[model samples]
Target chain A: MSEPPARRRLGPALLAVGWLVLLLPPFYLSAFWLQTGLFAMAAVIAAIGLNLLVGTAGQLSLGHAFFLAVGAYGYTWLAGSPAADEGLSGLRLPPAVAFVAAVLLTGVAGALFSPVSGRLRAMYLGVATLALVFVGQHILLNATSVTGGFNGRSVPPLTVFGFVFGDTDDGLTVFDVPFGGLERLWYLGLLLVAVASLLARNLLRGRPGRALGALRDSETAAAVMGVHPARYRAAAFTVSSMYAGAAGALLALVFQRIVPDYFSLGLSMSFLAMVVIGGLGSVGGAAAGAVFVTVLPQLLGHFADRIPLVVAPGSTGTGLDASDAADFLYGAALVLTLVFAPDGLAGLLRRLRLPRPRLRAATPQTSAVGEPAVGDTLKEQTL
Target chain B: MSAGIDVPELRVHDVTVRFAGLTALDGVSFTVAPGSIHALVGPNGAGKSTTFNVLSGVYRVASGSVRFGDAELTALAPHRIAALGIARTFQNIVLTRGTVADNLMLGRHTLTRAGFLTSALRLPHVRGEQRAHRERVREIADFTGLGARFDTPVSLLSYGERKRVELARALCMEPKLLLLDEPVAGLNTAERAAMARTVASVRDALGLSVLIVEHDMGLVMRMSDEVTVLDFGRRISGGTPQQVQRDPAVIAAYLGGATDAPVGEETR
Candidate 1:
């Protein structure tokens, strides 16, 4: 028998809607909103990666920002002019190469740290990962040549072949809209996020992904099943770090300059918050959570004067400023989401959908609660 | 089809396991023949589980060696041991978070060749391998009576169903020697019988040896080709079920019914 019509149509329907949403921002969103969308896209990519590592593999890492810094700075140094700083020497490679290299560099860095990552358990791994942040911060601050030290450095705009993401001498316009930096980047960011999401989803659904989930649940069990826990953990960490690298490179491009402060512990925590609030193990949910977390502060800051009981940054009579308000809002949201729905927003969405047939009777609610099915009796070889 | 390697008997020679001041297994030795069901029965703390652990490469031998085929298992890592055709289940269910199908596919880890990058790229080869493995997983799940619950999360299965899933998962490894720890520990009489039948059928169907660490003496007596009894970290007896059952030392250590009663009458 064929699948029900509704079930068959669901895939195309979801794809159609996803495409529409992805295409709408460049046409309708203002530059300010487009910039916000770009940041959200970057976060979406990173959060999906983090979910794979922290949620799927059950390895907690607190030094994601270290990899972000590596990506941002790696891109800047690789593509920018060597003479821009005292001892800094840029390879002056293509921005696209620089971007890809930056991501791979982060993977290499993660691989380097696998000695600790592969050996440590969840809580201890997290603690060990924290060391990456401190050590990264020290290098970024002291290595004035490569990182531009405390002041940071200017990022070279990404140029793919001949078409620059940045504005050209004869600035291009499409239809009635100006295709400036944000508009051009809107498309680029959209493509990257789409690819990233697809890849992450694909990874999670496949054999390796299942292996990772098994490893997370029980190392001994996973090992017996021929899953090398340490190897998988290291691979997950490296992949996740590479995703952070891509996000960092994108962020550097959007900001037009890079700073060590931008890739701080706070940034790492915000990424964690995104995954947690969106739903830990769901890739699509991570994107939604990323958008929510990234846009809230930007939106509040934009409408700071109008928002009730909220002031702009640097205001003296702050009940709560825009940034602080965003923090409080998301903090409360995180706590409420966890308490109300441990699975996060994705779980809530699942519940909102219409219940399907008894195709899957193995949900935790119905599982293992009562007597074995009568049909199962025949299969048993009771002594 | 997997390449043919000479399936050799597993020999444990004077293997000792010590944890700080306590010795979990003291000079325990036994051999499991090719394609035969070997039962390891002992009271709690008699080192039955420890023997399984040592054989499966989870515990290091304080002395002596374990030979599987020609390779020494005692020196290899757990996963390496698994790759060398030994797979085991836990005394406690150690299923990962996923549907019954997902957990079953995890058992195919050692068999699959695609790595992370190939998988991430969704290469044609990876896709093909995945389809082939999924087909096998489905068939195995069906064989183990879990075909209907392929997509069901393991956590939702009843304890008995979960135990079957665990067995199905181990079978997915396509091991030369299967290690089942407490396969029927929490099962009822009928379920225990069913489990015993399943294990025997699996051994026959897969053409592999079975090493079962079970508390249920009745199931062991019925299912095992050979039985070994352990008591207080020492081998008390070894022979066929009838021989081990009638051994005086086995009776003294277990059926003698000391204060720390052996897993005896209740199981029988």
Candidate 2:
């Protein structure tokens, strides 16, 4: 069936408007907002990857933070110059190469776990992956020469083709606004998010996505339709790990320091929260969810003094801490989303967009003459 | 709608399967000639579904072998069996959540070459391949009389329409052998007649072998060229509908040996 011309054009028009809106943030927003946006962008990339595995492929993972740590540490170790005095070892590779390599390294880590990931299903796989986070924490804490142990290591400024993402004496300015590390990296984050979203959207709308969707619905049906369950599961996990790696690398650049404690089980849970709260399999929904989860805590912390019943960090009072408040809000959101809109925000948005009840009546009558009216009645019954 | 690949004879030789301590199928053997309709008929728990599972590699056989052309199907994985041009529909409708076109495109999985990377990148070749497949899928949907519902989401379709979607999806594979499990089990009389017509036309037009597991004897007798009857996991009778209709053992197994009349005569 042909869609209305206006409706067909609406998607691209809205997309263009969104891109324009995102482009203005670096120029107009303060450093705090820019940092939060960058973190959200990173989350968006990771959440999309996780959604592919958990939502689309129907594989559950609880060790996404392990892969992210792999990416973060992988980049730091590869790009940091060796410091003999501190007993730190590094490859001192170019920042660009290190960035790409870090992602690949996480993919390799995921591939290494494929024997277990490919065999296990749903909750079993989640428990298996939970071990990765603990194992990763142990390595990060003990690997003194590579990871810098308890104190953590400072992240090297990302330099690409003689241009640095960090502050430079060159004093680069555009439209009378000084562009520092955050501003420069904002564009980079945007580019990466765009590419990641496009790639995910393409994948989900194509042959591989359908195969994975089929697998999620029924393994027997998927297999009979020529989709290898284990192979696809492994592939999805590897891809997801690479996405987490990229996010981790970007996060390192944003945070300006790499710490083992930050890449804990809590981080993985937040990522899971992002995808689930957004919508299981929708790319846009995951991005929105990531922004909501990442930005809410930071915003609460920023405005905690003004907002009643919420206190700033390190403050002891009768009120809840900002982080706790953020947690409570999203936990309630998760519950509400599950109860009212089980398909998540994406499905909710779709229902709002379409006049579904009316459309059933509006459907064209195409049955041949003398045919029984069984289809019409059945449709009504199902509805 | 004829596939370019040659249809292959499906030879099940003394196939036996057991789950735990229970034997689900014991030494059941049947051969489906190329370009013919073969029906596997039995009462509930008579191992019809078990045999279908075995043939499709969902379940491993305890003994005996199933061969499609020269390939030994018993040792291969399910996807590998599908790759060898065996496509099937579940007894219960198992259509994925999407438009009819999406489900039909899934049938082309064995035929299409686009992988995760190319699909993610939306490479030129992937688009071309999808367009080509979409055209053929639409044609198959028309063949199944689901042309009007091509773009309709499967959730919106009636039960009979969903069954047709499954059939169209199987046809999209362009398989040499099609396995249908209870194709018209839940359809109304009119819908059942329409489904029978579609099955007959698909076999006639595509010239592919079909092994059907059906509870409806009227549809089975009217459409199938040969019938294999199972009783308590054993092959009790095998022949044309008329031959099996008169077999005392077939009648006894169907009616619990209470009468000598042919099975399903009253229902037919």
Candidate 3:
């Protein structure tokens, strides 16, 4: 059977545009801007997973940071302390093994804790997962022997095939392109982002995806249809956690450090806000939401100082405080998004594209296909 | 997955149900042959729905047993009953929010357990099963007079169309016995007539035995081969419609004192 042109052309067309976006940046942007862009790109990767769990699955998680912390700590422990028991200090291990281990362990840990989430509904699950933030931070801070405690451990540079990455000891060249520091790291970050996005896409399109949607629509209906809702729900959580872990491993490599403070509740809240502002159950919404969220702080921090607010700046009020400003704006955006656009920003975009004038006239006729009204649904079967 | 037994298509023996202090179904005993359309009719609050809930495995029977083919219904879950070739429709439409095709596709979920990993990976098996599921549902839609609107979302559908989709979805399950509760409860005369035809055709086409709980007196009289009447949770009469219509207890329950002013009518 022949496939539609739209389906055939769609992926490659999008990929071409994505390649342009990633490869053309060096020609137009400065180093500092590139640095900020990389940070935002990394954040986008993490937010996509959060969007799936919260938006598509209708699960409420307040412990996304736990996965990131685990990923970072796990990578640093396994990679940087490969032979800790031996006399050699700062023992080195292959970065590939560490990355894989981090993602797997995080998935396992999430599966372990996800059972608690399965038993409870939204509010209780949110509260329970919230404890993960405190617990994760405590473990990272107190496990001095492995995590390196308060001062935080320095993450060794990742080396792929003898090509060292992130602020290299000495600059190196490969095929006329620099394979050191920021340049090498940028390629790695983009690669992770591409891979994660592909995985998330496949996930939301298949059986697990359908199961998640079924569970959300009606638990009783799902149960009646032979779907074990609890098991799939737990699986969604674990899969989402694995994505978070992968993103976190990349983040650790980018920073070349692992710290307890980076994975905080505030960071978790940002991911939540992104999913809320993005349409639930939508992949495009996740990307759009991440872009808005990732770029807003820059515009605000750089320009919001000039744009007057209620509080006077240069006073004790501290209106320009970056962290407080980001929090306030994110909180306000979430409430506004909920009230004005319950379906989220992506839904708002879809609404704009729709033919408002024809919506009503088209409904009945368009839906005339197979809808069995309430009465028909209850039609007495006679033989 | 066939079990060796001579269990009736459905056997509800001495099933008694209570609500607060009132009984909903008092020792209701009935047997449905393998291929028969049994009609249960009564006035409002007749405990017909309670019987449906018990039969479909939604509500646990307070007392007595429900056997479907070779499987015991009481211990089985609603979905399990459905899986065992006994599917039912609700009084209120329970179609999920999606395209008409999607709703029916969900019905085939039990039959199409394509592994999660295979589906996620978009394997050939996944595509094949999905195509088969859609084709079966499309056929059901055509039978239900919904051949045109397969892609339209249910939210955009009217009450009648949505109900059609719900029934089509259930029909796609290929049930041996279909339990339909008040299928013609709310509809215009023409729509009801069309539904009656649709129901009769679907049953005949699939060779399915059905249990119909209905409130429409004319429909119940015309459509059912046998009628069972319940009043205040107790079976008052069971026979052909002519026999049930002529029974004194049935008449007394509807009209008081044989053609005087009706029961509960104000003298003023």
Among all candidates shown, the one with the greatest TM-score: 2
Q: Which stretches of candidate 3 lie over 4 Å from their true place?
A: A1-19, A26-32, A82-93, A157-165, A169-182, A303-318, A358-383, B1-8, B18-23, B254-268
Q: Tens digits of per-residue lDDT for model 2 on B123-171?
A: 9999999999999999888878888788877766777788888898998
Q: Return the candidate ranking by DockQ, descending.
A: 2, 1, 3
Candidate 2, B71: how far from true, in Å? 0.8
Model 3 in CAPRI terms: which quality? acceptable
Candidate 1, true inter-chain contacts retained:
0.56
lDDT of 3 by residue, B1-268 (tens): 1223232468888898887778889999887766667898776787899999888777887888888766888898776777887777778766554577777777777788765457656778788878877877787787787777777667656677666766777787777788888776566676677778887776666667778998777777777767888887878888887788877787776665465332222121
Number of the candidate with higher lDDT, 1 or 2: 2
Give the winner by DockQ: 2
For residues A218-302, what per-residue lDDT tens digits would candidate 2 score against the true structure? 8889999999999998988999999999999999999989899999999999999998889888999899899999999999999
Number of clashing pairs per prediction, in order = 8, 0, 17
Clashing pairs in 2: none
lDDT of 1 by residue, B144-167 (tens): 778888887665567788888889
